[model samples]
Target: MFGDLTGIMGKLKETQKKIEETKKRLDSVLIDESSSDGLLKITITANRQIKAVDIAPSLFEDREQLEDYLVITLNKAIEKATKVNEAELASVAKDGMPNIPGMDMFK
Candidate 1:
């Protein structure tokens, strides 16, 4: 029984390492989002770090409109980044997990 526990602990540690590695990898995965009119564009990492933003000169004519575009586009980019981050991390964790009898958390 102790041996089994030790093996499970070791597996858990390995899984944690893989999850960390995946998180680092996700830092490089970029998600791009644009406004409906294509006046604003945002790029973010799967880790939800903003990488770049490109705005069309037309959006500069109105401050409120530019702010609204930024809000909407950034939110969309963040949502997409979150989805990618979660999926990638979950995949790594699930694949590396040990087959413990009562551990069906992934399902």
Candidate 2:
């Protein structure tokens, strides 16, 4: 029983180490996402901070349309980036938690 407990403790420690390492790596990983019309794009880090946004000048011809497009495009890019970040975190967490099914809370 003592040996089993010790072994489990060691495993837990190893899992924690992997999780930390994954977080560090994810922090530096960037996800580039764009909109459907290619009029807007964004680069975001896994931590959800916007790095850059690209807007095509032609979209600015109509102010209202431009505003709507900007909102929609930015939303799409952010949503896509968030999904990418979640996927990455999920992959990393899965490596350490193979036995626990669908444990995506860490992402």
Q: Which candidate is the best by lDDT?
A: 1
- Candidate 1, 79-104: lDDT as tens digits: 99999999999999899888988989
Candidate 1 local lDDT, residue 89 = 92
Number of backbone collisions per candidate:
0, 0
The regions of model 1 sitting more than 4 angstroms off are none
Model 1 scores a TM of: 0.96
Model number with the top TM-score = 1
Model 2 bad stretches (over 4 Å): 60-63, 98-107
lDDT of 2: 0.71
**Cα lDDT for residue 27, model 1?**
92
TM-score for each predicted model, relative to the true structure: 0.96, 0.66
| Residues forming the 10-long window of minimal summed lDDT in candidate 1 | 92-101
lDDT of 1 at 9: 94
**What is the Cα-based lDDT of residue 69 in candidate 2?**
73
For residue 37, what is the lDDT in candidate 1?
86
| Worst window of 10 by summed lDDT in candidate 2 | 98-107
**Could you list the CA RMSD of all candidates, in the order they appear?**
0.7, 4.2
